[model samples]
Target: MGTVVDAPAVVTEKEVVAENMLGDKKVTVVFVLGGPGSGKGTQCSNIVEHFGFTHLSAGDLLRAEIKSGSENGTMIENMIKEGKIVPSEVTIKLLQQAMIKNENDKFLIDGFPRNEENRAAFENTKISPAFVLFFNCSEEEMERRLLGRNEGRVDDNIETIRKRFKVFVESSLPVIEYYDAKDKVKKIDAAKPIPEVFEDVKAIFAPYAKAT
Candidate 1:
């Protein structure tokens, strides 16, 4: 943690270009992170409805990229299958593209920058998150939710879910800690019922509310 990690020069140049492009639009990105079944998608939808913000799920975007058969699609697909984190460069590029394509200035980007590589590479983008919304829930509860969600997703099985949870604790927690160190994380107790949890979320996002 003490030593600095540098991204490749090419990554930096590309990210800087993206930074300059998004910078002109004055983008506001809020990173939404949590375990697989942590209700991040549900809450992000609520935020978008109540606030004038776009919701972009990193996983969804990657999936879409795969479906579209983009050049990086195969790599992303393989990584996802093995539960490996995709290169931060690819995810960041997708995020930048989404941000640029949307008309909304503020966006809630769900499920990204889940490791130190991501955290470090993101520095070059210069499109810093307004804050990170961290959802905290018990593994037991998350596991139950994942089993019952019936999404028919490949990773919804108990084996994958357990592995994902372990990976989250090992990798994602550090990203949360980094943001916490910077005082840029809003922790939400997601173990509660959906509406009740949103009530708390609404309070944190009150300032960003849009006129109804």
Candidate 2:
């Protein structure tokens, strides 16, 4: 007879809090925003290496929830499959968990706040970003890059990509506009090569760079 195995227990938000993951430490956040394939991820990697900030991709966190077999896993998976944004509460919880788990207080949060609801939820937490790093890229260029990315992401198909682009235009842009009105956005021309893009990113992040 084969032995039965139990699934790993899902981590609850309450449990996360019990662990003091969301301690009383002050947090510094930088929102990284762009169209899909705008090289936000690539440049964030550079900033983390040079500036000592942790990179936390919202998409990655949600995907991890799906992998963890949590109760919300199925819902998150469906949303991502349809290129729809997950609920703000779910996303916020994941981001909080990541922040609490990491030792660094500074974070580069990528691919989040897909709409006003997300923005409000995050604001409710009373943790505002230091600045928003906006990566500007043309749709034609972004489409080309997503097609060639070959990262085996389920949402990488042309159909899902188109849906994602539509959502970004309709839902995500306003969040950027809101920060822009506050003069908290640092726009970058991301159409350039990866290295060149990082150069511009480096300049914006220079103030936060850690000395050797």
Candidate 3:
């Protein structure tokens, strides 16, 4: 198992207390939202590697279910291919169970709360992130990257790609707006190269990057 790092002093002083007051809990969750190929996954990896936070990727969880050959595996795989979100209860349950099993205070939850209903469910569960990281990339660039991803997944097709973009515009926009209104959203330009993108992400997380 990897070693856990010490919580940053800034986080301890600023967010920890307030977050504790909100739930009287120790966990610190940073929710990240972005459209397909917006670099959310890459940034999450960097955050976990540098900051020692647990990374909970919703997309990965869904993919795992699809790979499990369970009763819903086929259906889940089809949904993912079409860029449609899985049901909230299913995903929220998965997230809760994962968090319970891990027992980590710091978490970077990637690719979650895709729609308003999904966001509300998380909020209803009394789970709130210290802040949200939103990746803002142009539509053209996003399409370009998604096409290039060529992950041989069902969702890699052009029809589904366009559908995903449309769904993202319609369903995910309000969630971002909500976070923006609360003044807890950090927008990152995800159109740049991976290293440059990570540099910006690193700066956002520098306060928490010290090795414990």
| Candidate 3 lDDT for residue 170 | 97
Candidate 3's residue-wise lDDT over 23-102, tens digit each?
33467788899888898888888888898889998878877878889767787778778987677887887777677777
Candidate 2 differs from the real structure by a C-alpha RMSD in angstroms, to one decimal, of 12.5
Candidate numbers, best TM-score first, in rank order: 1, 2, 3
How do the residues 1-212 of candidate 1 rate in per-residue lDDT, one tens digit apiece? Answer: 32334546668787766763484687878889999899998998899988878998877888899998877898899988999868889988988888888888998988888887888988777778889999999999999999998767987999999999999999999999999999999999999999999999999999998877
TM-score for each predicted model, relative to the true structure:
0.84, 0.81, 0.78
Name the best candidate (by lDDT): 1
Candidate scoring better on lDDT of 2 and 3: 2
Scored by lDDT, model 1 comes in at: 0.88
**RMSD in angstroms between candidate 3 and the native structure over all alpha carbons:** 9.5
Reference-based lDDT, residue 21, model 1: 48
> Candidate 2's C-alpha lDDT?
0.86
lDDT of 2 by residue, 70-189 (tens): 778988988889997578988898899889888898999998777888999888776778889999999989999999987889888889989989989999999999999999999999
Q: With candidate 1 superimposed using the best TM-score fit, by how many Å does residue 156's alpha carbon deviate from the native?
A: 2.7
TM-score of predicted structure 2 = 0.81
Question: Model 3: what TM-score?
Answer: 0.78
What is the lDDT of every predicted structure here? 0.88, 0.86, 0.81
Error of 3 at 119 (Å): 0.8
